[model samples]
Every structure is written in structure tokens, then in C-alpha cells.
Target: MFTLTTLVLGLLTATGISSAQSGADGTGGIMAGLITPHAYVQKRVSSYDRTGANADAIHIAAGATATILDESGPGIITHIWFTIASPEDLHLKKLVLRMYWDDESSPSVEAPIGDFFGLGLGQYFLYESAPLSVAPDKALNAFFQMPFRKKARITVTNQGQEDVDSFYYNIDYRAYSQPLPSDTLYFHAEYRQATPAKGWTTDWKSNGDPLVNDKKNLNGDGNYVWMEATGRGHFVGVTMSVLQNQDGWWGEGDDMFFVDGEKTPSINGTGTEDYFLGAWDFGSHPFSYASFGAPVKGEELAGSRSSVYRFHLDSPIPFTRSFKATIEHGHANARSDNMFSVAYWYQTEPHAAFPPLPSVEERIPRIYPVGGPGNAGKNP
Candidate 1:
């Protein structure tokens, strides 16, 4: 299995850039590539006004789309930056971001703009990670290296009822004269949600009761799927935002990964918090890191909200035929909270078609009344 370290070190070869031109010492960070560069032309396509006017933002009407980038390339996108001003409620969740690689009709990347930037609740609080971040004052940034052979296109659609007053963006990419290496893979992200996961029963006394904990879920039958892909690639990470419908701790669930379409998961984790590199309900506090974080830690009560993320940059799980990344809603699939997530990966195209995104109303985060600690013994 190739790790992100291997991928980063192999970037020169993957992008058809010779080692002599890169001058990398294998000791410095990604900055080592900056020491020597002989080949590609670095370019940027931003929302700057073509007329060279002072106003450099685009206005997108409700139900309309804005083309952010359209370029012919044997190139790789290095960075993407965006800042927006809007009036619609939950505007971030209503804005859909899509990317097409090699002129494919279907997008390889389709996710809510906020979710794609690790703010799945449509509300942003500053958080930073290796490949994605929400910086100071609502600046959304991404550093994923997206390589395309023939063409690359990116668009954002306003699904809200109100028009987007201002949309600002800048996409930086490298234009290569030479073709990318054959092993280079395209990046992809897909969004999915379960307004409220269904459990066998919600009348349990506690999370550890035999009625809940003893029910085996070895196959991940009712697991909330983060990503399911049919291709050759590895899952990079996930951003998950949760709205609590039921009360009490909402993370006794375990993380499970079924690689290459196996009947059972080969990778199983201890618990939800543990999978994100945290423990004990994230110590009931917020934390952010380069590879994993719980940026929004919620109270153990109904209507609470939490957002967490994790990137498998250290050891990406590789799959040959398929990959299914899932996690139990609660131990033995026993919680009914609202779950929304974006799964990130790199794979060979033409990748599997993504399911249609939920309607704007459906995507909005809200708590649903379900029976748990809040009303454990009541009918639900």
C-alpha cells in the first residue's frame, strides 16, 4: 500500500518532471520542490473581472451556476481559494461544487461547497488540515493536487432561493508540456447523508446494555457509508458533520472498511472518536490537526451539532477492485442521529457515478426527534 509520503515523493515522476529539475533532497517538506523547477508553467484562473474593472467578484443568481475553471491541460491543480458573501440561510450547504476531469460528462468531484471545504454544517469555524481548511474570516482553501490529462472544468451552482451577492475564487494549477505519468490518479469527492439512521430499537437503557451492545454488526449492515468506489485507488479521508436527534453520547459506533468487496471488513476500529484520532468523546473539547480533528465538539444533548474530520495521509487504504468505507451509527447500529459526510479519494477514471445530491431542503442540517437518552422509554 502506497502512503501519501510515497505519493508526495513520487510527485516529480508522476507529473513527468525529472528529478534533476525538482532538486528534492527527500528530507525537506513539500517545499523542497521549490528549490529547483525547470519545466511546467504555473498559472491561475480566478474570478477577476475580464474587463479589468475594480469589481472582481461574480454574482450568481438563485438556481444558476458559475463556471469557476475551464482549462485544457496535461496539468495539475495546486491550490484553490474562495471567499463568498451571501444572504441565504445555510448558503454553504446550498452551493454545489462539481468538477469534471478529462471532459467527462459526469463529475468526478461532487459535494456541497462547505462540506468539500470541511465545513459540513454550512457554518464555518476556523479549522486547518493537511489538504483542506477554512482559514481566517471565511477563507476556504484546498491543496489537493488534481491532475487531468485532456481537460478540467469546475463549477458551482447556487441552489438556494437567494442570489449569491458575491463569489470570489482563485484556482492555481500547473500547465505541463509533457503528459502526466500513467500511474497518476484523478481526485474525487462525494457527499452522502442519512437524515436519521434507523436502529433496531431505541428503548435501550444505556449504550452498553445487552439490547444494544450485544447485537453483533460484523458486516457493517447498517453502517453509515462514507464512500463506496469501484476502481483502483485509495481512500484519502472524510469530513463528517452530525446533528443530534437523540440524546446522550452519540459515538460508540466503530469504523469499518471493506476493501476490494470483501464479505467482511478487514479494517475495524475501536470507536468513532478513536477513528478520528481522538478518544473519550474527544475529551469533550475541540481540536484541530493536520491529519485528524474534531473542530466542533457538541454537548451530549439533542439538537447539538458536531463536525469532525480525518485524513489517511499516513497510510491510505488501497483497493484493487472496490472500496467501501463505513461506520456504525452507534454500537451495533443503534443510534439515529443525522449524519452528513464527504468522502475523498484518488482513483482511475471513469469512476463510478455518484448518487444525485439531496435537495437543498434535505441537505440542510436539522435535528429529527428520535428516541434515545432524551426519551429512552417513550414510544418513538
Candidate 2:
């Protein structure tokens, strides 16, 4: 039911008219009366290498390439650009915009396209930009309203640190049939810890070792514990240690981290009370320990009495993957008897200042039971 000479020969064969073109309302030659000769072209089908020596950072590097532009169905991706001609100062941090239909382990949807002003994942969608200009080429344009599902994949990741060598992109799928409704959000994160060692007393030179100075228990020696899995993706950093026997506190102790198992309420005014990211209170007075960053808000650091806490989530604890954490005690008289010698090392990889080895092997056997009664007669 289209006749204006078949909608001006389907808009002159979708803007490619040429058959001795003739348009002046006489409508005798508008690509031969009603355009429909297979239109849709704006291509650049391949490009790859997201880093040197087999990707995944080995020298602070970055790389990316993917393009398939509309193969069918209502389309108008307009623009999805990139250009960071490296010159230094490219700490761009997280930029993942994935839309892979039926591949890469069944992905039908995903989103996070060049988010710099709107944080992304950990929550803020877009509102933070200042370092994308290098001499004359550092661009980013977004207007992706997509809907051509049979096949599509666009992945761009460079979680900030500046060193993004090169980039330039374009994707404008055109067509029209009415179909647009998909914004993408699938989220993921995984790292676990805990096994067969509860509350206290793992037999450290036994004599009912709950700390009469079994080196302050928990296999002491500058003791350090960790655990933090927040809003889902952006905190990227952590590595833990402790497997039994060291007893004799003096290198520092207490570095707890258990952010999303609920129940972190204990911060009562001090230097860092947001779930205590760092602590080494050797009975205070001149012995210290503290380090913080990220939205970890206060209180809940109670454990000590022959302590025994072990945890490890190395990196990728920001923007969810999957989480759970436990183990807290820092002197209060030393005898909380906590014990979890192993389990807690998750990964998605991206936080290496040094220390890398533990990417999941599965271990679980510590059900909370050592030096019971919650500190039976506490005294420091």
C-alpha cells in the first residue's frame, strides 16, 4: 500500500539511487519505480589483539577489535567511537560494552559502552571524565540503540592505568521495521574461602592454646587477613596469606576484609572505621597498621586470643561475580580463636603490583567452632 511512486522508489533505493536517476515528481525513474534492491552497507568486519604476548597484561598494555554491523532487523546504532592515540595519562579504568549473541558461552546481551562519566558496574552509569585528550586525538561517542540479534559482539576493556596505544571505531546499522527494547545487565563475580577450622585452637604447641602467648594464635607473624566484595566491579585489589604455625605477633597483625556477607556494624570513630581495611594494634602506643580506599564504611574488627584467620580474593571484587567472607579479631585481650586456614581467592584478573598465584581450585571445611563462648573471659 505504498505509492508516491513507491515512496520515491524506496527513498531512491535507500539513498543509492543511480539508474540514470530522475526525480522531479514526474516519478518515471526513481531507481525503476519502487526501490527494494537490497540496501545496507557500512562495513569493517575484522580486527584483533588486545595486548602483547597473548593478552591479559604482562607489561601494562591494551588492545581491542570487533565489528559486524547489522545483519538483519530494525537497526540504527548511529555511533560507537574510540580513539586514544596514547601519549601517556590514559588511566581510563573499566570500559566494557559486550553484546554477543549465542557465542562466548551463550551471551545474548551485555552493556557498559565506554563509560567514563557514569562509572559503570559498581553503579554510576556515567559522570567522570578528564583524561582522554592527548595532543589532538582522544575521542568517545555513544548513541547505541541496538536490535539485530542473530549475531553481534563488541568488547572494549582497559580498566585504567593509561597505556592504550590506539583505537578508532564506527558502527551504524541501518534499517527499519520497529523493534527496540534492550538495555543489558548480566553482572558476575566469584571467589570463596573457609574450611574445617573453627573459632580457635588448631593445636599450636597445645596447652589449650587460645593464646597465653601462642604468639597470639592464628599462626602469628605480622598476621594479615582480607575480604571485600562490594557493589560488583571496581575495587580490583587483594592478596592474602596464612596456613598455620607462626605464633609470636611482632611484625603486625589484623588486616580483615569481609564486605558482603551482611553484618559489618562496629565502627566507633577513629582513623579508619569502614569495616577496618587495615589494623595492626600491638596493644597500641607505638605499634601500627592501616590502609584504605573504596566504599567500605566502618566498625566490626573483633578477634584475638590465639587467632587463626586466613583469606584471599586477590582482585576483581568490584561489581559482583559472587561473594561471602568471615573472620575478625584484633586483640580485645586476644582469644577469639577464629580459624579458616584456607579458601578465599577469586579472580577476573586486573591488579598486579606483585603477587599472583591462586585462581580457584575449590576448598571448603571450616564451620566456626574454636575457643567457644565468644571470648570466655577476654583480657589484653
Candidate 3:
């Protein structure tokens, strides 16, 4: 019988203070408890679908507890390991690892544990025939390696159907003051465009022409737009938001995103979803949309005026002189204006290879309007 009392006790007992531990060097030394082992047991709802709609579902009574054992690191985290124990066989689709940094307001970083490494998404990451090999009473173990900074809290989420009665985890981490080889960097550029008429359609071009006129024209009004930094570091994560005026064109038509020299894929949904790197949409709404996809192009169609957009890179990116964005297409109803705003950030180091691109299922679409009478037959 797993109770809250047991869970709390588990955490407390697992976190016994380390009186003194030997340093990496054989020389005698005294180290604080910073590198000591810490543990936590928590109950969470398994809610995430990796595959299609037919994916398995997780149905467990609320308050099922999971014990997480964590070891602190010096600076960058090298790897993590854990195990899961369940009363019955459970179909797991995916696993999410979230890190709560010193700042409790939000997690420093959160990603699918399997996907973070080379492991594929969802059950695919698991070995076929054998989901995982864990004895009834024994603890299963796994490992994860990544470049990390500062202290962090990690959480494992089960996305598979079936009930996970209980589980235990042991995470091993190595920290160092030396930065990783790959560090993320961020840069910003400003763009502005003007159109001929109030209802005229135009494309907001980045390199070729400031004003573009074609079926894909997107920038409507002539105002200053801004792009901000959402994610940064060696595993450079990029995200931005767009604030625009007017509303007519479909959500897909008016948004665009460009990385390096090529354009990214588009995302599904509206508002922030349409915005690149936007993880949360439907602000202050009844329903919550938590779909994550690869980066995509964005455009603005309906709303004009000033809109903010964002971009994210999974790894450290080279320092380029400039990056650009443009409105692919816009509506012909109200005049649409587009502008660009910029911000800058720096990474500690660079990575060996360019970050991996997102999968098709994880791709996000550009920004566009949804569920409005004015937005009809406006996408290109």
C-alpha cells in the first residue's frame, strides 16, 4: 500500500547526507553535500500520445507514486538512469524527462527522455517484444547523457496506456565546470514591409525584396514586428511569438519561419501554435493543446500591425551575420502590415554537429487564424 506518508519518507530516507566523498582525484579532500544523492517520490497522470490516435492509453488511479533517486552534478550533467515497476503490464507510448532548475517558476528544460538521446519516439524506442526488463520486486535501470548546466530536477512521464502501479528510478549524473563542445547562440534581425493598398496582398521577403506580391504574400500592415529568444544554450532551443492586428485569412497562410537559409515546416492550430516554438496555445481557454512538432514556416494573413514571432534550434548554431523572416501570404480584406523586432543572446560553446531536425509528426505550422467567418479560401 503506497501512501503519501511512504512517498515522503522514501524521499527523505533516500536523501541521507554525504559526510565526505573522495574527489575525482585520489588526493584527500573535503566536499560539501552539493554532489550528494537526493531522491523524490511523486504521483503524476500519464497523458501524452506519441503515435497516432490508436495509441495505447494509461489508466491508473490518481495518486500512484513513483520514487525518483537523483545524484547532483558539478555543472554539466552527463547521464541519467532509472527503472519502472508496475503491478500489471502497461503499454507505454513515450517518456518525458523534465528538469526543474533552481528557479521553481518553470523547468530549465523538458524533453522526451527517449527522444533526447538517439532513442526513437514512444514505444518505438523500447525494444520490440520486450518493452523493458524489470523484475517484480527489482528496480529497472536506464541511462541518459546530455550537456547540462546548474542544478536540475528531473521528472519521468509515462505516455503509454495501462496502469503503472509503481516505479523506482536511480539517476546518475556527472557535472563539470568545463562547458560542452557545442554551445547555443542566438541573434536577431528587424524586417519591415509596405503594401500598395489596404486590401492588397503582399509577401514579406527577407533577402530578395522587402515587399513581395504573389499568392503567398503575407505581410498585411506596415508596422514594426519583433522576434524574441525563448530557448538558448549549446543545445540551442529557439522560440518566438507574433503579435498582429486584423483577422481574416486562415491561420496557415500568414505565418512563416526560416532557419539558416531554408524555411521550416508549418505547425497546426492557431494563435501561439501558429507561432514558431510556441509550446502553449489557447491562453485562458477551457481546453489545453499540448502538441509538439518540428519547426516550420510562419505567415501572417488576417491580423496586421505589430506581431511578435519566435524560433528555436535544438543544438548550438553557428553565429551568422543575420537571420530573416517574411510573411508568405496575406488576406485582401483589411490592410496588413508587418515589422520585425530582434534580440540577442550568447552560448558558452559550440556543438560537434548541427542539432537534429524535428520529425514530420513533431513539425509545427506557421501562424494563421482559426474559426472566424472572415478567414476563408485565404491560404496559399
Predicted structure 2, TM vs. truth: 0.21
Writing each residue's lDDT as its tens digit, candidate 3 over 306-335 gives 222222312223334322233332322223
Candidate 1 C-alpha lDDT tens digits along 1-380: 53433433355232222122232334344544455543678799998999989789999999999998999988889789999999887899999999999989999999999999989888989987777888889999887779888999999999999999999999999787777777788999999999887776877766668888788888999899998999899888999999887777889999999999898999999999999999998995899887789999999887889999988766778898899999999898888888999999999988998988999989988766577677434435
Q: Pick the candidate with the highest lDDT.
A: 1
Backbone Cα, N, C clashes tallied per candidate? 0, 60, 71
TM-score of predicted structure 3 = 0.31
Each prediction's whole-model lDDT (CA): 0.85, 0.30, 0.30
lDDT of 2 at 254: 34
- Candidate 3: regions farther than 4 A off: 1-70, 81-96, 111-122, 125-150, 157-170, 175-228, 231-315, 318-380
Which window of ten consecutive residues has the lowest lDDT sum in model 2? Answer: 125-134
Predicted candidate 2 versus true structure: per-residue lDDT over 1-380, tens digit per residue: 64333332233221222212213234433335445443444443222345543332122244433332324443434344554444433133233334443233432222223222122112211111111111123445432233342344555554444545554455555454433223222222222222212233333332234463344333222222333333333332221212221233311223333344423322121211123243442223211121111221111222321211211112223334433333333231232322222122222322112112122122211113333333233222
